[model samples]
Structures are given as structure tokens and as C-alpha cells.
Target: MATEYLSEKHLRGFDKYKYNAKDTSPLSIYVMHPFWNSVVKIFPDWFAPNLMTFLGFLILVLSFILLSLADWSYYASSRTYPQHPPVSNLVFLIIGVGLFVAHTLDGIDGKQARRTNSSSPLGELFDHGSDSVISCLLPIGVYSIFGRDEKDYGANILLLYLIVCVISATFYISHWEKYLTGVMFLPWAYDFSQLALVVIYIITSIFGYEIWKGTYAFGFEFRYLFVLTTMGGSVVLSLPNTIWNIYVSYRDGTGKNRSFFHAVEPAIPAVLLFVVASLWAFLSPTDILQLEPRIFCLTVGIIMSNICCHLIISQMTETRAKCFNWLLVPLMIVATLSVSTNLGSLELYLLYCLAAVALILHFHYACSVVVQLADHFNIYVFSLEKRSPKAARVSNGTK
Candidate 1:
């Protein structure tokens, strides 16, 4: 039966396959769009799509830095979990608003490009690349808001890490689907999840961080239950959906069995990073959270960023997904250090610095790929004007 379906779809030609964008969120359609469309209209003719992408990323980075500083201070004071966050309520408010605005700008960049007649694959790469970084940062910020203690070895800590992994996996799979079927699937959960983060910030701002630390009707910690449910839902809902999508694509011949490596290759770095971190956490004498809570977050953020970078590069170059092998160096170093001896504060600091360097290098690769693709396509990264209209025409035809 599978062979018959594949044969029929092959005869039909994969070029006939259309990319589908699915979004069922009423909040996004009824509430967000009305407002977002209005804001897009106000964007001046000269406002470049890539600029909006970069600006949104800048705002998210600022929020992450503030949150990290606050978290480090709280950890340094030897504060226990379930306490109020050390940051001011005003900061939470600002972070919430900033994230929302970032989301807004990200959503409209394509429209801005279309309006300015400057749409290119580079615009898509920039938008997704920024999103990849923001995805890691946003969850880390939320974890800090919950005042999660990384020092403790418990189910809750494991769940927290699992939640981060699940988020990254969903993102990875989404891009994998794009690689396979050439369609970007926007699940309803994606938008709602972002809104939920925004709501968390608002709640922290109004009722104070103590609210998140409190128990709910079921006598479970609210944050614990939230993370548990997120992990559970991904396993229950998302995992199955992803499998079904792959199956359908194969049946439709939009995806080829010979290209399975293309779908799985981008995930190799992420998997390796996760395994190395897990080994380090288990083997080290000192708890990773105890070493430096912020460092753990940074490690996770960098791994996710590496994964995102690989996805963007693969898309831009139209090649099989490749891992950022340089990232493995720090992970291997940390893993080796874990069982060798107890790492002092100085050693931890050095590790943090190394991770930061890895992050910078990963982003450099992403940026370089975008520049090369832009130059090849003859489109300006920050302008509506094409560098070579004839080249652009030729590229469009090839695409």
C-alpha cells in the first residue's frame, strides 16, 4: 500500500505540493492581527524587514541579560527556591512589554518586505534565525522567574531541563519538516505558548514572584505542574503529530526516503550537546546549579542557538543539515573536567567564557551564511533596492 501511494505521488510531481501555514489561535487572528496590521501600516517605506528582525532580537537579548543578572544576584545571596525574584516588578513589566513588541515586529517583517518589494530568502532566514535565539532566551528567563534551584537533584529539576529540551525539539522538528516538505507549519501552541510567557511576566509584575511559588487547587506547585504539562503535552500531542506528518509526506512523495539523513542531521549537534550536559551534571562532584545557576542557563541557550544556526544555514544553502562541530569542544571539555576533579569558581568562570565564545562563533556562522546568500541573490540586506535586478530575476526562476 505504501509503495503504491509513493508511486502515484511520484508520478504526480512534488512541484505540485503546496506549503501550508496552519494557525488556529483566535487570539492571534482576532486580537493580535488587528493590532499588528495597524502597526505594520505605520512602518515607513524605508523600514527594512531585516532591521525589524534585528531590532526584535536586540530587545529579547536585553531582556535576557537583565533576567540573567537578576538571577545571578539571587543565587549569589544563597536564596532558596520559591522566594520572590530579586528583580524589580518594573523590570518584569518592561520585559513583558518588550517580548510582546518583539513578537509583533517579528510577525510583520515579511509583510514589511512584501510592502517594500524586498522579499528574499534572506529575510526568511533572518526572521527564523532571530526566533531561534529568542526561543532559548525566553524559556531561560521564565525559569529564572520561577526561582528554580539548579543545585537540587530532584524530579523537578529534571522536568525543568526536559521542558527546555522539548521546546528545542519542537522547533527542530518544525524546521526539519520545512526541509522535507518545503512548508512551514505554525502550530497553534506556538502562539499560545508565547502569550503564556507574557502572561507569566504580567502576573509576576502584579502579584509579585511569590505568586508563582505558591500552590494551586491541587496542592501542587503551579510552576511544577506547568512544566510537567508542557512536557507531557509534547510527548502526547506533538510527538505523534510529527510522526504522522512524516508519514503523510512520504505517502505524498513530497518527502523522499533517500533524504532521511537530511531531516536527522541537523539534530545531531543538539543531541550530542544534551548528552554531554547530562553526563557532566551526573558525573560532577558539585551540582551544576550549585556551580553557577546562570551558567547552566547559558549552556542550554548556546546549545539551542547552535541548533538554530544549523537549521538556518541548511535552509539558506539548500544543503543537508550540518552540526556545528566546534560546539562539541566545550561540551567535551566540560564533560572531561566533570569526573577529573572538583571545579573551583575560577574553572566555572572559564567554562562560562568558553560557552559564550561558542555562542558568538555559532551566530557568526549564521550571519555569514545570510550575507553570502544575500550577495548571491543580489538583494540588499537592509534596503529595498536590488543590487542586480537581472540576477534577482534569474535567481527567482531557479528557485
Candidate 2:
């Protein structure tokens, strides 16, 4: 039926806005419309299949709900029941699984959209946008279980990093849109990063050491060389894949702001500070027990992750017009400076406010950017459908 409807003769005669037809291409190929045709064909008369964009949003929403419920500190139970450390590991494992599951669902909506020829800007926006929330929220949810408070200035920093992710993603997408002919959006790799982090957490929960440090012959204390190495390596490993995605997105024709220099942007000073601080920790034996490696890892991860977030948000064409985003670095600076100022209560209050403000702004910007991106994609898809004879006919029939 779709073939007949999209046939050249019919397309030549058809009014673009007045008719709708199906594009009977293998429904499997489109990421956004997974199972739509099969579902529709199985019960064409009884049920309407939602577009992949809708499904992706739905899954994202559900994932957030699940994360909200999964306490990161469920591992505390292990502390109480020493004999059953496995319980804590199990709890953490479950949370990790939930995260992975959410990540998995992340791709389905895109797949579904493609299969049904129902791809839209909203779908693209929603699919990518939810990531900002998930990225920050996942860490927060996990950290909260680790005894961190939302009020912990660090948590707020994580949220700030989340904003960066949104910025970076936007930057990546928009910049690429400028140069690339089509979206080279490797939705899989992006999703895989989240999955790998979950695996990292699982490793942490199962073994206190970050690496599989075996006992040295006749040594009283277990050597932790492997753990430190892995943790360091994981951080490094994460950086390239992330940068690759950003590079691909920036160079791709789909994004609009294409500058070679900008593509190789510098690490934010804050990130450099983190690297310095981390290197300092590793180099100075005095800082080891005082600044726990795990805590250091988490902090550095939070900072670096946010850097990615910033790059993601930068991908968006419509974001950061407001002056407030510019304040993020200064605010982070202020918070860091407070530790040195010795202003006691004043420092604490100011840091608190900075974190609170950053979190609110980050989420606000992310949500807004994602929505706008979605709208733009929707318009683009609709325009393409209206302009393309085959697409026009298919769209009309669908309506």
C-alpha cells in the first residue's frame, strides 16, 4: 500500500499536504521506530504505535523515576551486616543494572522513530536532552547512597557538571550540524559511556579496591597498585571516546558552528585545577589518607564529567545567551577560594548559595535547550516531509 501511495506517478499527482503514505523501507533500520511496523501490522486495527521519539521520552522519564528511587548508599546495609557485604554489593549492583537498563532504553526510542518514518526534531532533542539529566542525576542518586547530601557542595558541583554535559552535547550537535550533511550522532557510544560507569560502580561495590590488587608475598597489607592504575586509566579512557564523539559531531555537516580551533578547545581552568590537584595527591604521600583516593576519584570524575557536560551544552545553538552561564566558572572559583579565605560561616553560606544557584540554572538551561532542539528538529522533519513527494504522501496517510 505504501509503495502504491509513494509511487512516482502518485507522488507526481499528489498534493503534499493533503495525503499521507507509508515508506515501506525495512522498518528495522530506523532507530526511532523500532517495532512500530510489527506492532502496527500485528494489530493495525486495534492499536496505534507511538513514535520512537515519544517512546524514548517515556523511557527516559521512567529511568529518572527509577534512579530517583534507587538509593546510591544502599551499600550502607553492608556496613551494618558485615558478614553480608554481598548485600551492599548487590544493592549497588542493582542500581548499576538500573542505570544500564535506562541506558539501554535510551536507544530504543531513536530506533523506533526511524523505522516508522516518524523521526522529528523533538525526538532528537528529547532523546539527547534527557541525557543531561540522567548523567547528573545518576551520579547524584548513587552518591546520595554513599552518604552525600544534595546540600553537599560537591553534589551541586556535579549538577553543574551536568549542565556542562548539556552544553557540550549541544555544542557537539550544533557544531556538527554546521559541517556534516547528516547526524553522525553515535547514540550508542554516548549511551555506552553511562553503561561503563555503571560497570565501574559495580567493580567498586564488589571490591573495595578500585583495582584487583593481589597480595604481595609475605606482605601484611594488600598492595593497591592495580586499583589505582585502573581508576586512573578509566578516567583517561573515558576522555578520548568522549572527545571523539564531540569531534565527530562538530565536524559533521549537521552542526552549524564549525571552527577548527574551537573544535580543539582548551580544557577549562577548573578541569586543569582538578588534574593538578589529582596529580598533587598522587605525588604527595601526605595527602593520601587525608584525601581518600575514592573521594578524589569521585571529585575528579564529577569535575571532568561536567566539563563534558559543558561541551555538550555548547553544541546547542540557542543556549548560553544569558550572562548567568558565564558565571559558572567564577562561582566555582569563589567556592574554591572560600576554602582558603577562612571566613568560616560566611564561606559556607556563600558556597551553599553558589551550588544551589548552579544546580537550578543548569537544570533550567538543560531542559530549555533540549525542548528548543526538539522543536527545531520537529520543524525540520516536517519541512522535509512537506517538501519531499514521497515523504509528503507517507506523512499524509499517517495523519
Candidate 3:
């Protein structure tokens, strides 16, 4: 088989086979319309064997993140909105299921790419870009839908979500590029962090005052210390990805003069604030606890700080390359800020518009590549297959 040189520019036009080369080649597996094939090609069977395995690792990482985040949020919401209908817990369940579904679909696209042999640079560009956007937006959207009316509270939740996502993605990307090169990166240690948080949440939900009674196991309250531990641990554990990213960036001559150690934000203060909030809550009676505006207010502040941290980190790394990962932050902020105050309607028009634009652009670049490849090969090989001297020369050499 003759090997062809594929350039970065040709990614949008790589789907065609030889004009009259018969159906003997593997490329024929993708003979359908370039546009449709590219769209369908993002499944498991399309991925090369190696890529499929890597995709599995990513799916697991994503699953762990989903499970931990869901558990923590559910525990918090249970106490934070104790008066809301039991139906609210359904939202957390739905998010958990959604994560699983999204991860499964994510696994398929790579396989499709491999099975059809339609893998191209632009397809990759779209896939990674989509994941980045979804990672930052979905959580924020959920928070807005459920907690938007809580004034700065909802806004804060969305902000922190944005921050963690930005830092995590940036670091993961930088780390993967540095360590794995051709393989997808996995943050295995991150699972431990999530596990730790789940434990903290369980303790907080059950005990309430053990953390701030200042006697270790003496007063043994579950209070706000629980929220602090979970949130603080989340931020602290998130350091691995960020630190790895910074290390990679600096080693790659990209970090310039940025201080590595200085980048570690003071998680202590935030953790302490959470402790104070928890103590206040613990001292209050069960009934009053439900009405405390501070419960929602402080939660929002923590979330907002998280978001701000991510934005700042993203902006700092703007000129360092691969800056598109930050695109969701501003868009998410805009959407959250623009929603109706009552949350009566879903108002998904903006979401729909964004999804459509991304899809159109993703497929447009892919289809153009495949179609162009078909055109080029059709003229080059099929037109003069028997007549061209070079064809005979190449054919003879093969034998």
C-alpha cells in the first residue's frame, strides 16, 4: 500500500479513497458522505486500538470526578435547602447519570475514529475542545438552574466550579503533553482526593460539631468544618494537576518568570472561614439552621472564589499556548448572569445556540478534509492508473 503524507491543513479534507481504486482498501470503511461519516466517526470502533485504551483511562477519571462532586453537592444541598421538596435530590441523581452517559458516549467517538480510520487533527481538536467546554459549563449550569435565586450564592457556586475546572484542565493538558506525548493522561491520585472528600462529607453530614469543638474527638461535631474540609480538600488536592502543569510549562520554556511556589493560594483562610461558618451553624438549633441565609451565602462565596482563581490562572497562562480551554469561563459567566430570576423556565436557547455553533464548526472542518482528500486522490491515481508511467513503475516495484 502506498503511504500518503498528511499535513495539518488537510485534516478537514481527509475522508476520500482512490477514485477507482476498488473497495480493497481499509479507507473504504468510511466511504459514506464525508460530513456524515465524520459526525458518526466519533465512536469507540473508530479509534485505533491504542487510543481506545487511553479513552478508557479518561472515562474512569471522569467517572470518579463525577461521583465525588455529586456526593459532595448532594450532601450540601440536603442541609443547605432542607426545606425544598425531596424531588431536588433527583437533580443530583440525574447529574450522576448524565456523567456516566457522557463518558460512555465519549468512549464511542474514539472507537469510531479508529474503525473508520477517519482520525484527523481537526477531529481531535473538536473532541478535546468539546470536553473542556462541557467540563466547566455543566456544573455551573446545574447550579444556576437550582440555586440561581440565592443572590451572590448561585453566582459564587458557578465561579468556584469554573476555577477548579480551569486549573484542572490546564494542568492536565500541560502534564499530558509533557509526560505521555502520544497517550492520553490520567490523574490517578485524583481519585484518592475524591475519596477523601466523600469521607469528609459523610462525617460532616452525620456529626456536625466534631471539627470546631477544638477537642478533636471531644466535642465531635459535624458542623461547617465538614464543608470546609471537603471544599478545602478539593482545592488542596486540585494542586497536583496545577503544580504538574506549572512544572511542565516551566520546563518547556513557557512559564517564563512566574513563581511556582508562590502560585499556591492560601487555602487555609478559606478553610478557616468554612470552619467559622460551620461553628455558627452548629450552635444554632436545627430549625433555625434551615433559615440561616449564611448557609447559602457562604457557600456561594466559596464557589465564587474558586471560579475567580480559575479565571486568574487562565488569564495568566493566556500567552502560553492552548488558551482555548478557558473559553467556557466567560461564556458561563454571561449565561449565569443573564438568566431569569425566578428559574421558572429552563431558558435553554443560549445553550442550544452554543451547542449548534460548536457542532457546525466541528463537522465543517472534518467534512472539508475528507471531501478534499477524495478529490485529490481521484485525480492523482484513478485518472491515469493504467496510462501513467509512474503508476506502472510503482506497481512493478510492489511485486
Candidate 4:
């Protein structure tokens, strides 16, 4: 089945695909976009857009892995646990530099594609596909900054789960909205969020993570203000705007204009993702979330990224979206076994197994899709060149 990830139906849809997006973000319009327009010029025309996309993702992963290793329990900076030894000030600097470079590369890939005359649906897919993973990783890394104490500063384990879900949902829905409406309603909050996080990481690098602790106004911790703003941007700004854009598209007869049920079909998998992860965390006999927050977050984020990838494929190719995601079945079984059956260490092992499976499936899917598309499109995914004519002829004959 993995070999057939893209069927004839999907290929046919891709043949007709054209990228369309609406980005009215003041930041993107007046600031980042212009900066990217200039920054992209520095690159040689030989630079591949997909290379930038993939490299940026790798940089972010490097920073995330290094930070996780340094702050495994995510309390290295905790005032309440001084013996935990604060994350080296250098880690924050690494993350800050890494994120800034990654974010900049992301902003310019599309512009680079357009400049090099290499624009295609494949580039968008690669860009946002990596983006889906970054969506989860960015927040999980930020959680380490605030640390895991609800009263002193950082959010507890449960709240962090919700934050990851909310951020992932906002991103997934934006793409899903495109599936329904045929227009990507780019969120203004995205640019601000990335820049803000970079600034925060930089601030921590200079002044230490302790700056976030105990600062208060109107009887609430300042860290909670970040939490409220993050969640609020999703529930208040991003989602409502997405719904409105979809509604307008349908009302004006510009969208796919399917029935309500069909329009909402893509949401089932996304909803189930949150449900399965929540059940596992909330019902775990071992208190998996609190006892093993890092693994839990990584597991859930990988699963969420896989789901988002499926959604992107559906939207980009105009293929019928899945009403039920396949990963949910196995994940649900894992959750059930962890909670309903007594397995002691095996439960944590099950969680490990889940993360492993999730990671494997995600990579397999990403790699297969990229190879398939590269062959079909007669292009290199990370190089500014076309495939050999012989290979292209063979690819077209079969696929």
C-alpha cells in the first residue's frame, strides 16, 4: 500500500493542479515578504527551492534534538529545581540561530522557486509538508523555555498537549480550508508567531530563561500571557477567518462547493488524532504524560504531522480526502492497551513503539511521495535539474 500512496486518480488531479493563495498578512506583505524578496537574491540561481525547504527542516530538527537531549525533563531552567542544572546558555543561542535561519529559508523557498522558474505544486507540498512537522516541534521546544510548573512559570504537561493540538489544528485547518475553498487563506498570526518565538529564544540566550518567571500584571504570570495569546490567535483569529473564507468561497461559488458533509470529511482524521492522543495521556496508568512528557509530545506531534501530510495531499491534488485516517486505528489500540491493560514498563514501551511506528510511517510516506512526484514531474527534489530523459520516459510509461 505504501508503494501505491499516489494512485492514478491522484496523479490525474495533480496534472490539473494550480497553486492559489491569499496572504494579506501585514507582516508578510510589508516586512517578511519584502525581506525575503531581497534575501532570495543572494542565492545563486542554481539553488534548489526544495533544497532550502528540506535543509531548513533539518536545521530545526538539529536544534530540537540538541535541546531535548540537554533538557530531557524540560525543567533544566526551573527555579524550583535548581539541581536540575539549567540548559547551557549556548543551547538557546543555537535554537535561536537555527530557527531564524529555518524560518527565513521557509519564507524564501516559494519566491526562490518562482525566481528560478521552477514553481510547481510539488514545491508547495514539500514546503508545507515540512511545515506541518515544524508546527509541532516549535511549540514542544518552547515548552522547555517556560518549564513544566503551572504555578511557578511554565505550563503543566496537560496544557502543553492542548497547546500542541491547537497549533497543529490551526495549521491543518488552513490547508483543509484550501481543500474546500481552493484558496489558501494564509494566517497573519503565523509570521508574528515565528518571529516572536525567535525573539524569545534570543532573549533567553542573552538574559537566561529565568526572565519569564514571576513577572506579573493584573495578578497573572506573564508566561500565561504567551499561552493565552497563542491559543487566542488560533480560536479567535485563525480559525474564524478560515471558516469565513470558506463560507465566502462557497457563497460566491468560487470554492469546491461540495455539500456540508463532504466539505467536513477531512476533519474526521484530525479530530481522531487529538482524541486518541488525549485518551492515551489522560487515561495512562503510568501517568505517561507527566512521567514522560517529551516522548508523549514527540509521539503525538509525529502522528499529527502525518495526518497533516495526508490533508495536504488531498488538497494539493484535489483528491477525495479520507473520512477515516488509518493511523488512528493502530494509535487507538495502543491507547487502549496502555490504559485498560496492566503492562507496567510495557506501557511505556508501547508508547515508544507508537512513536517509532509514527516516525517510520511519516518518513516512508514523505520519501515515497517525493520520489513519485520527482519522477512524474521529471525533476529533482533537491537539485536544480531535470531527471534524465530515459528515466522520464520510463516514469511516464508506468506511472
Best by lDDT: 4
Residue-wise C-alpha lDDT for candidate 1, range 1-399, written one tens digit per residue: 011111222222322433245554577788877777889999999989999999999999999898877765343212464453467888899898988888889888977887887776667767887777776677667775655444431234455566677777777777776666555656556667777778888988888666765567778766667776666655665566667777888888875453666567777887887888777766767666545655675677666776776665454445556655677887787668765877766557656776777777767767665655564456777777646665452322231
TM-score, each model?
0.82, 0.48, 0.36, 0.97
Each model's lDDT comes to 0.67, 0.39, 0.36, 0.86
Give the 10-residue window scoring lowest on summed lDDT in candidate 3: 17-26
Better of 1 and 4 by lDDT: 4
On the 0 to 100 scale, the lDDT of residue 337 in model 2 is 57
Residue-wise C-alpha lDDT for candidate 3, range 1-399, written one tens digit per residue: 333223322322223211111122122233323433454444444234234433533554454354445433422333255544222334334444544444444545544654655544333433444444343333332332223223212223433433344434443343333222222333333333333433433443354312223323555333323334434544554445545654676677654334433333223333343443334333433312233232233232333233333222222222122213222343344244333232222323333344444345434533443333333333221121223434332221221
Q: Which digits, one per residue and each the tens of the lDDT, describe model 4 over residues 1-399?
A: 235478877877788998898898888999998899999999999999999999999999998899989888977867888778899888899899899999999999999999999998789889998999999988888888888866568777787888888999899888998989998889878988999989999999999988888767787775678889889977787878887998898889999988888888988888888887898888888899998888888888888888889888988888888888777777899898888988889888888888888898888988888878777788888898766767563343453
- For model 2, residues 1-399, the per-residue Cα lDDT tens digits are 211212232222221212111222232246334533344343222121133334444554554445444432323222333332323455556666665545445545444455456554344444555454444444334433332222211122233233333433333333233222223323233433454567766785677322322345555222133223323333443445445655565566434454555433433433453445434333443333132322333333334334444443333322221112243464446545544445545544454455455555555554554333323223332222333333322332332
Summed backbone clashes in each candidate are: 0, 66, 40, 0
Q: Assess candidate 1 and give its TM-score to the true structure.
A: 0.82
Tell me the RMSD of model 1 versus the true structure: 7.4
